[model samples]
Target: MMRANENARGRLSWKVAHRAIPFALLLLAAAALFHFSVEVGEGDTLAWDQAFLLSLRHADDVALPLGPAWITTAMVNFTSLGGVTVLLFITLTTIGLLLISRRPVEALFLCVALVGGWLSSNTLKLWAARPRPDVVTHLVAVGDASFPSGHAMVSAATYLALAIVACRFLRAPAQKAYVFVIAGSLIGTIGLSRIYLGVHYPTDVLFGWCAGSLWTFGSWLLFRRFLPSQA
Candidate 1:
């Protein structure tokens, strides 16, 4: 009986590891594609998206005006509640989870996914170098290259990662579904806010979302394999 149990455990471990391999491969492939896209000047569709977003930013009656401030203000400040801050929070949270779970491998995987996503986003932005929308004045001034939206990319990675971690703790199918829904909604809201604030082009947001999603999903697959059955 003892030998049989050991064999069964080993088989489960192998199956998990096998499933993770594809995700790791996918991450590598995405990195390579990101590099290629950077070298080639094929992904520059930010102009129109920026224009549309700018229009929304300037609208005085787009949403309810609570005195003089709106949630959009928080979205506009990249350093405040924007991409950079959000990413930082996500990174810290992942670290905390690693510490609590005492799973160095899982923590490392999350770190790689986060950093990898950031690097990919920046590379595409610099390579594309699409100008921000000048048609409508920008709500907040930005000088960085504006191709693929950083906010979109970071939000996708952070939220998706959170969802993955949450899944490990939540056993009920309904609970897991709820967690994923919330994660997806947060990511989507952030991306749209970037567009609505006249900061990121629609295409930039779209690509960012796609790239981030791919990385997050890929990392999740790889991380799952390393986890014990209870984990």
Candidate 2:
């Protein structure tokens, strides 16, 4: 009986440790994001941001980015994926699909996640009010504050939310993994494209990724807890 109790306790402990890992990671990510935001807001990250921007530019021509001419075109194309029109179309299409499938709850949840994330992203950018980099000419036209890349944040939240929704319908583990991998790749590429285009600082992208991910995950957790069937 004592041994049986000990085994049960061991199992409980393992379960707890497994669950704790994600929470720990989430806390760490949040802390890192907050620290970066504060530092960037104080102008502490200016030198770092400038250095990375210059590195991506041509030595003789700060206007022209490094790499072949084709790469610049490619990045502009990729960056568009995170633009307002594209994301709105994707979100509406997904929502329509969900509604057609009789998953209105999940559809609503997706809207909340994406729209709220976008608003939060915009608010943070306004609050940060960090000027766009002048160390290099922007490959793509951009306006407004630049601390947290709106493209990065929106793409991360949109893709991550969509991936979570996709995972629910997917039966195969490999398929679910594929969905998440593709989502992550898209998020990463979109963010990198912004930096490569000289419109966003590396820290801007980094903080955007962190903030967007946390917001989506938090929304997901709430959805799961309150609407388990939909989640």
TM-score, every prediction? 0.72, 0.87
lDDT of 2: 0.88
Off by over 4 Å in 1: 1-51, 54-71, 77-82
For every candidate structure, what is the RMSD over all alpha carbons to the true structure, in angstroms? 6.1, 3.0
lDDT of each: 0.70, 0.88
Residue ranges of candidate 2 with Cα displaced over 4 Å:
1-28, 226-231
Question: Where is the poorest 10-residue window by lDDT in model 1?
Answer: 58-67
Clash pairs (backbone) in predicted model 2:
none
lDDT of 2 by residue, 148-205 (tens): 9999998888889999988888788899999999999999999999999999999999
Give the per-residue Cα lDDT of candidate 1 at 40: 32
